[model samples]
Target: MSATRICALSELEQDTALRVEVEGVPMAVVLDGNGEVHAIGDTCTHGEVSLAEGFVDGDTLECWAHGSAFSLTTGHPLNLPAYEPVPVYVVTIEGDDVLVDPAVTRPTN
Candidate 1:
């Protein structure tokens, strides 16, 4: 539940997605277009699909199955078929390591 070390910060490339599990929580860690790290629920809200396997365009990750675009910071679905928002975790970088806290997430709206 606390901030757990997920991986090395160098392991993530800019604008790429990395699937990680912390405290049994499946998450997708992304280095966005601006080279900022973000953590969000890996599963798509609309279907049984992995968001890590989806497309990363800027800060939006589109579910490959239903094309549901979820905001990286807010985790809100930007389009249809997925009215619910995914969970966005808190990512902290310590030196060269990436830490994520699954217990902490952005407020859903």
Candidate 2:
């Protein structure tokens, strides 16, 4: 598993997400409502839009393109037009840096 530093923890606001690229793979790093960090695929399963452009409510991340919602923890699609699950990466906060495992993402089923 290859890990890369994407951003600082302080760089992310609460209940918001940031889009990043790790080794050419698009990723969305989110700060949940509980203040926990999560990383998921930036692409919307419903279409070719980016998930980072969507909104975050609690632990659910919704795609702005089609309003498809997904679970940040399991990467499961929670709404229509997006039955297939998206990849979710493992995130670890070390000090102020956000560390991500590029090879450990959960693939869409």
By lDDT, the best candidate is 1
Model 2, position 35, has a per-residue lDDT of 84
Q: What TM-score, over all chains together, does every model reach?
A: 0.95, 0.93
How would you encode candidate 2's per-residue C-alpha lDDT over 1-109 as one tens digit per residue?
5689999999998888799999989988899978899999898877979898899999989998889998999899888989988888888888999999889876545
Among residues 3 or more apart in sequence or in different chains, the pairs in candidate 2 whose N, CA or C atoms overlap within 3 Å are none
lDDT per residue (tens digit) for residues 9-63 in model 1: 8999887788999988999999987879999999998896899999899999999
Clashes of each: 0, 0
Supply the global lDDT for candidate 1.
Answer: 0.91
